[model samples]
Target: MSTIPTTAVAIEPLSISDRLSLVWRIPLLVIRCAANFASFCLSNGEIARLDWRQKLAHAYLRASRVTLTRKQQAQQRKLLTGPRIQGYCHRYNLEHRAVSVNNDTLYKKRDIPTPVLHFVKNPTTQPDGPTIFYLHGGGYHNPIKEQGHIPLALQFAAACKAKQVVFLEYSLSPEQQYPCQLIQAVAGLRYLLEQEAVQAENIVLVGDSAGGHLTASLLTHIVHPSPYAPPIDLRGRQLKAVLLVSPWMAMSEEQIKVLPRAPNDFLTRESIVRFSNMFKPGLNEVWSNRCDMHDAVAVWKKLFPTSHEHAICRKAMLAVGTSEVLLDSCVSFALECMGCETIYVNGQSDLRLVKEADFVLAIAPGEAHVQPGMDCALGYHDGKMMKAISTFLEAC
Candidate 1:
């Protein structure tokens, strides 16, 4: 996608007044978008009172046309200038167990297609178990910085006693756009499938926010290509499970209205709008062709470009916060998973409907938007969240 502005409307930096207008005006479009979105959250009685027409009208006022180029640049710059996120080392003083860490390959090479850096943690004997294909989230813009998500991955590795954990640093949004990110995700998973006789059922795809959305997308579009979807071989590449936190699954005019808009905290409606434009700065040409959610034929066509690949569906955990604006949509989307085996409940999700779900748990303190590890920074209760997640994964 080109970085040049498509509109000749004299591109000028937004000013205070201009931003104010945007703050008020943009909500209309978002609200309109939200109205059209399918509501799997409200029950038959609750939905009866839900005002669809009003939500639809409001979303229209805030929606902006998706741009092509500038979005890519913004996301790129943010990623380049972000802080060096470092995970806590397992150098035990009195907290967690102390273990010797050895991963000299950390930052050894950057040009590699996929870089798996090590996190500082007590080195437990590697367990003979399934592997985890970890995908970090950055709203399609930034990804887990070098060693950023290491702490979380290391914890999972210890609990599962897995042989290996591959952190696929897929190119972020904006620059990579839709297909590019999906391409790498598919390629990365496929690479693992080919390298070893790994059972598709043993591999878990883990992530949060945009990572969760990408996970859902991979399930929706990859196995079955839409008219606009690119070509990819998704044969025999199975997954054991999908673990997502506060995953941003569906994006449309309707869903945007109901998105969380808190600031400097979990998710904010305002920031989401801003970042939404920043990432995927341009629409994927492939998506334009077969992008039909409302159309039954289109959705069917979009979902399956080829014969059923027979990819065994994985058990999934879709966790969210109680106050999350996306709470409704997230749970709805989870239920719609073509072959969802299990759905673990989060406090946020339970606030809505609890159907076809296995278990529901309360939200931990200080738990903000979809964070996998390093909850201590946010003052979140680590033991409760992680223990529940691990238990759910182990049960299946």
Candidate 2:
């Protein structure tokens, strides 16, 4: 086999702020971890009375606040023009991994390229297995190269038993607008089918956060064509499944109030507004199509104005947190997937309900955006969460 190309980038030295954050955060995190362990050791009834859940939730919130505050400072510097900003880019890498360590190809706009990372248990000895076309989420701004993301991707690849995890690094936003990423996503999928010789049914499209929305949009296009966007020649390429993690389905201002914000949710309303505007800028064509949970069907109808591609009933899995702000929208979208009426989960409710339709819903309690995957990899969930995902992949 050909040697895997280097995709990992160089690791930068930790900044003062990073060290400061760690100095304080690490101790607190250790305390929280110990508390969590204690909670786990206790019986369910005893644990509830001891209120370990609340303690864990509060600890997470505190940590999230610290990270968010630091990130905001970095975001402000994003508008600056100087070596400082350049250094910041190099330091944060826009959350991408260093290009020095990875084996995936880096695609640029001119190349009509799609960055793909293949993970197998044994690269030299393994056989061709299932394909997971992973679209990562960063509100359309972050790339998969972010810290820990490569390992996270590998973890997902392992969980799903994929021989090759084709990560479609569609162009990021603000630099590339709405349909650009969508178009790139379609192109990437088609290229995988045509160039890679991967079968449609063997491929599972997986996405998280904004990536989930892109994955859903791509599905709509494949099953139902939109004249507004250029057509992709799918040629009846059906996928094994579409796994969405905390997908941001819609961006209505009204949604701000419709769903009560999670006390510990990391994403802020202001952050969402800022990024959404940055993504589309002046145009509302695709932005207007954002769903409100209940509008999943409507959004689908609008996107696929002609015949509905019923082939979307193939298989799907949506993993979301009960405490996530997008919980309502996810439920609504899940309802649409089941071809049933929308049912909104109350903000105060932490009920872990698993419903079956054309898709499966994996609800993690007291969790926020992308935490399950992160937690699973970091050993926060004790492998249970990853195992659940592995089971979902097997079922698919």
Q: List model 2 lDDT by residue over 179-275, tens digit each.
A: 6667567666766776667788778888888888888778776655544344555555557777788887756666544765664566666666666
TM-score to native of every candidate shown: 0.58, 0.66
Candidate 2, residue 307: CA error in Å?
A: 16
Tell me the alpha-carbon RMSD of every candidate.
12.0, 8.4
In model 2, the worst 10-residue window by lDDT is 95-104
Q: Report the CA-based lDDT of candidate 1 relative to the real structure.
A: 0.47
Q: Please report the TM-score between candidate 1 and the true structure.
A: 0.58
Q: What are the per-model numbers of colliding residue pairs?
A: 26, 13
Per-model C-alpha lDDT, please?
0.47, 0.54
Q: At residue 305, what lDDT does model 1 achieve?
A: 23
lDDT of 1 at 354: 28
